[model samples]
Target: MGSMSPIRGCRRTIMMSSVLLFFVGGMSATDGAPPTWTFVTGGRIVGSPVVTETGRVYAVAEDRYLYAVEHGVARWRYDLRVRPIGPIRVSPDGTVVVRTRADSLVAVNPGGGTVWAYRHRTEIASFEHGGDGHVLIGDSAGVITALSATGRVVFRVAVGDSPVTTILRGSGYNLFAATRDGRLAAITDGGARVFRRLFEARIEAMASTADRVIIALSDGRLIAVDTFGREVWTIGVPEAARRLGVAGAHIALISDNAVWFFDNSGITVGDDRFDGLGDTVIAGDGVFVAAGNAVYSVRASQPRAPVARFSSGVGAIGAGGGRVAIGTDDWVLSSFGNAHATSRPGIGARVPYWRTSYDYLFLKDQISAGTDQAVRATREMISRVDRADLAGSYHTIRELLIEVATPRTPRTGRVIPPDVRSAAVRALGRLGDAVVRDFLARAVAAETDPLVMVAIFDAFTDTGIVSPEPILEIAARYLSRARGAELSGEIARAGVDLVIAAHRYAGYVPDVGVELLRRAMEAPFPREIREYALTAARQIDGR
Candidate 1:
């Protein structure tokens, strides 16, 4: 059986912060349950939730919806016909552009109503808006699609070996796509003939300032490239990591557990002794990082502080205009106290969560008896949230539990906060149900904190020769959006280690464990974690 739970955001391309605050008396990291989570809500969470000017946050989620939430209440919701897994493109005209999971490119009015929707041949993995309302997008099969303002498809060309991330830039309309196989593809207005492959490993993430293109390689190198695709400077870290995003000249990237920063020159210059982001000292640092339990502010020369501390680690950080938004395990979008957050009227008494939240249970109910039990537990837990003597932001989540969860699961007992789902995931490893498998995948996709992913490592086993490929694959994609030092390194190692660790479950796998041994030799983990990984590797190799 598999263990359930994991959740994983965004901001300035995101570096640049002039805000700071001191945090005291943190909330329950765990609700004292055998394994618990403390999910946080109160922000704008669009699919690509980013902090905006004046402190408003925006984000979109799998709910097939886009949200503008400030404080604990939603500002508006624009429903889509399908899921939205792509980043949002805010046009200069104040138009909100979104790419749906069904491969539709749609434009929305600021009022949360649809203005246009364009469908394509394949599911759209992502999208971006450029000048004259031209939207650039890439599909699951490595094809790029360009659409005009009126939802008409203009260009659809195949690009990259495995295009995972992309950006549209330059007044001349140059498109950049970072691929899984260590390549960057550039598409011009005429077509996407420009291409360049770099590094021996995967390109986990990509970022660009006005003049520089930054690539976060799967092998742990932060390689800077010019517009001509020429390597500028390559900064390598102790462990293979990913670059989350860059704001102005400030860059935020992550390895496993900790988040860190660099400058336009590619030097590690942010606070390393503390949280590393959102600090008074790094007031002008332009870098923002969301780590376990906190969203950080960092500058090149100073230490950092917390912007709004939550019990759970942030799944993502998004910034726009003057505000910031965050996503948590509970799948809720939250923002800090900004004018929009404060002045924004109640979501006009709209209900929290979508009607489809509980529908997942019906979809999987016939799968097994275990599925039924799990669903019932979740729903039960949600009910307690309504009557339990809970205080704080959790009060706002009661409605979500009822709406998002199926009555069959009711989620049992006290509210499980996002911070502690890791323990629950670890404990549920013995159950091999498919429900567990799917939930685990979801947890990983939205997980912003590595501790939670670490917990998941114990739950699901690939059941093969203990190949680290799957885990590495997940880590590579995760590092693509992950920011900061502490987090980048830990997650990269864990993802790889999980691959080696899975061998323990096979009992009769192969002895050709080159990746495992290599990881044992070169992985940048604490002695204890390294030794554990080595033992798991040895089990597969019989060494």
Candidate 2:
């Protein structure tokens, strides 16, 4: 789930009931509908489109032109005079850049004037924009070059024999690059090598933050490595990732037709798919996925049927400055939402927003269906409702959640599946209120499954329900299983992590974590649990 940025205002923000669209003469909106507009261009768009704060759209078309569009009109156009070699890049200073097939990098200002141009000997394969007027360009010959804002060659690094396929800019002056021959290299702002790692399979996609770099291999395996190039964890994805992007707290893997989301720990949180060759880009609080003739908007915090879909072949997606824009194959550039009200599609009429709940409890479907598509939708809904305090439908949704979570005994020959019950227990906590607290208190008291007990305890922290009574009750039950199932150690550790997280959420000082850790250490817990407790204590003490 996407972490909520500090509560921005007193007004409660609501997630869309479903994708937003106006019912036209006879058309009804589906779960993936949203209001949109499109501007047909002169040629096919090959690179990604960028939306600036002012709602101006920038995109490159095969017609050898770079366009700046606003309110459905071309504000300015910079003639590249040659087809772009790779993705279009925009710098922090609002300079648009594209490496042309003519072996030159051209930076154009918003006014359609060329700021500067740099010539290179080899074909540029990929490039990344590092702030402070720095641009990192990599070529087919495995060479990486750092260019100053004024088009000066700052530094260059060469790797193996294959082409450089991905370049990711990191915090400060550091940047990372990957080659087709399975080499990952990091470079400092001064163009010095930080570290490099080689893999067996070629890299298909890459994304990074200040602390970690995530790479997707050709074999559908995703790996996360720290700045030092040490493997943190690896996950086998169902499909090879065609593009990787970071939206808020989730890592997005855009596959052939689906978008998979992973949390910081490399666990699959949720995913959604569409028909067509899809690509994803982060825009505001949503993930705008472009596939075929439509662009779907998936909220970063929760997946509720796509909140919106626009009719356009979105080749590239970009969001910034409170607006979103997409470029299509038919030479159309479009912007969506209130920022471009004058260009709103669908009869160009205002539509009032309506709030509603899902027809069925998705939490149940996720646990019972066992299908990839069903699980994805269910997880998305759970993640969204867990964080979205939707007050309007709270009573109705709460009643339904309670009904689903009611524990019951089965016939003699069958028993309630642990997975199914666990999902119920989790839904109770996500509801996160007095009624939920009452339900959880009774359920945990009789819960025998260690896994369900652990999930319940974790949800307390997840929902910010910090009652000490339930915390103590579940903690004791968790510690009782210290030497049980093989996963007992893992569950115990998770409990400790949650306790610390809860303390942080409640605005307690680090000493509170220190105190909790000390208590766990002094208890007669298993050796592994005690060791883990001691480590957590020391880490907190250092703070």
Candidate 3:
């Protein structure tokens, strides 16, 4: 669930979501259906896609380019030097505003012509266009910029090093900028700091809901204040989510991938089932999931119903009048309540779970591999994983992520992909069902992959299937008969220190493991393996 950022992996400002052509198409009203997939290449589409009243979908990709799409076809594109990291925002009337890490702000007309362009004093983060002819922007340098409708720089004020909180506007063109530096300031459209309040921590989000204000803070807490800036209610969200949506007397948010719908009264009324989403939005009546190569619309109800589903890598979604405008890494779709299923392999509702479930391990690997930008692209790739459908290569995919996570430190984070056997072992351990214990034990006995074997070892450990007796037996086999010292060394790779530490705690530091250590003390295995095993047995063997 960690976002793809350099310092912290959860920030949205620099993220990008881009994946190449994949063919997974099949989606029906029922549980089992084909998912359709298409390849649309422009660049990483990390920023959420936006749709105006006319139904044109606006999206940006990592190629540092912004594009407009309609009805699944490409339109005009605006290429930029610095990638647009946040979603394109549209004013209620139809003006489009885009922000880039370069602090470059640009506005365009509906025809994709540049209406105004102004490079900020520093890189601007997420921004919004106010109906009052002002564009509000927040940047990583803790500065907020307000520009006139004509792109004239109005005023700039420093906030802190963190990205600006959501630019919030209220009645009479009053503007508020939330800062992570623990201050909420009332500013005019010109970016003049009118008033300020000291809060508990940095505020991450600020929004207006008809009558009250919603300010979500860095501490994973939400503070509702009145128009006068007095605190009314404070709600705490222990697990942070990516985006916050508040409008029409309702609050839509997520924690741990579960969408929580709260009314203006702040009462929890509805929630969509938990599913991992690279990005999400709250608009109209449905909760949309921009999961790994596709987008899905799940209604907010007693049992959420599926309204429409499209390819993963979808970075943005806008809902209205039975239509949901979706933007993916490469393509865009304006689904007008289409519930039709596909024939090609396409991700269904289970994507968010499977991708997030198995991808956590891979996500860690990718993070350990590379730069924040490489990781930004990698995160979007993992977000769209569905191995059963050959549309996505799980192994090649993992390799790509490993390259991105620790690109320079390639020696590690390249662990072999867990096959069904390893996955079965983990499953048995988790299920606690005794029936599969022997099967998992046998599979472990015959396993060849060192990484998979250790994972098997953990599964058996988790299931209490491996005791000192079996450990000793396996150690004896590996010691003399099992002719694979290299593999033994591989098992010894994750650090025999932790293994010995666990043995010291569990009283299972096997005598045979010790004998193997003693016999192969000079073998190909690293000195650390022998040292730890010998040290552990001597320390705890009751000899």
Candidate 4:
């Protein structure tokens, strides 16, 4: 742990005074006003901007700086020295709290001074602040540690066997912890375990009201549990819920393409469908949604015109103190007050396709040129072939990528770079052609580079081939080789990725793949390998 110090500096801050004109989408407001003030950061914003009740804004960017902005100007920015994880929270005492990639929780005061920093032993999975100025941090080891405002530990308790995914403060000092394996526990203020309930599916998101806790499961079920861990209601949605927001008796559920609004009784009131919505926050009588390149306010499942739109895609949105803050993908932060803004469309461009055989001939010539520029051209070809609608040249492009990715003896003193090979392998995986699965498996067998091996496993998983024979053979070979020897971290991680890839085809070869993974569980590999093997084996055995 290092000393608490504020990194004093400001990135170029742009303050907009008037609205800029741009093309408006259908049903968009042409007379929309611009944001009251806008701020730019050095990097893309990580999570949603946090706006306090006093109109102070706090945002964390990929540049590892937590910025405090007031009236369109940066008040101060504190350097976390590493990327911030999860959300930036404002505690009850007005102290800004943020978790860093260094596994530490840093507290910054209103004056941009460091108050305290508490380092955790394991990777933090869930973090929350209570009303009484206490911070509850959950780690991957399933332990919950509570710290007071002064950053002293109050209690540490193990809640489950898997990683804790969420932690929420319930009525009074009672705390609720949800694990990755779907177990929810209620702990007392003094860290006494009261009860635990296990669900059939993983919990994805959780929100709390005054009287009950709302949870969204990976199986598309929204469940409400009381303070005593009793279920109140459970309703299934068409798709898995991504985020949840609770406001009074209204509940907002955001999925991949739609937003569903429900009453307290789990009855669907209204729903709206959008293409690229990411997050939602409930304020007053409406829920503000981050969709595409704009933030929209929806009431009764209908978008009440456009609220604010930006040049780039909006990553997150927040509202407080009669103001709204939006962070865009291009590292722009804008604050609005009663302004209806619209952005220019065309964020997504059409994928270029091969129109004729000459296109394939040109690419083949570039790949066969055997130079550094050729390697760059090959990389560009990989990107172009990924997810594009290939016109009759799919096999040609796939075979070209396979040739570049396959480990072979160098010819004419020409060798493919490891990263280029990995990218080519991943692009083949994204192509999802079943014809390439066998090639990828064989590559995995001959591949010695750990990164390329990981890419091969990822490709196998991405192909959705459903044949478990290749993965099982490769996993068995690795496990047998690692029985008496310690594996490096990269090798161990590749082994875990192989197990996970095999898990995808568990239903196809239950007996062999499950047995191989079970043997891997008992093998003398790293803890991560063993854990992943156990998890895959259990899923295959339907335990």
> For each predicted model, how many residue pairs clash, with residues at least 3 apart or on different chains?
102, 8, 44, 0
In the range 343-431, model 1's lDDT, one tens digit per residue, is: 21111112244334444444234223454454454444434332322212221332233222212235544333433344445433322
For model 2, the run of ten residues with the poorest summed lDDT: 342-351
Top candidate (TM-score): 4
Clashing pairs for model 4 are none
* Model 3 global lDDT (CA atoms, 0 to 1): 0.52
- Arrange candidates, best TM-score first: 4, 2, 3, 1
Alpha carbon lDDT of each predicted model:
0.49, 0.60, 0.52, 0.68
lDDT of 3 by residue, 316-360 (tens): 666543345555544443343432211211111112233554555
Looking at candidate 3, the ten consecutive residues that score lowest on lDDT are: 341-350
lDDT of 1: 0.49
The Cα RMSD of model 4 versus the native structure comes to 24.5
Q: Arrange candidates by lDDT, highest first: which order?
A: 4, 2, 3, 1
lDDT of model 1 at position 377: 46
Of 3 and 4, the candidate ahead on TM-score is 4
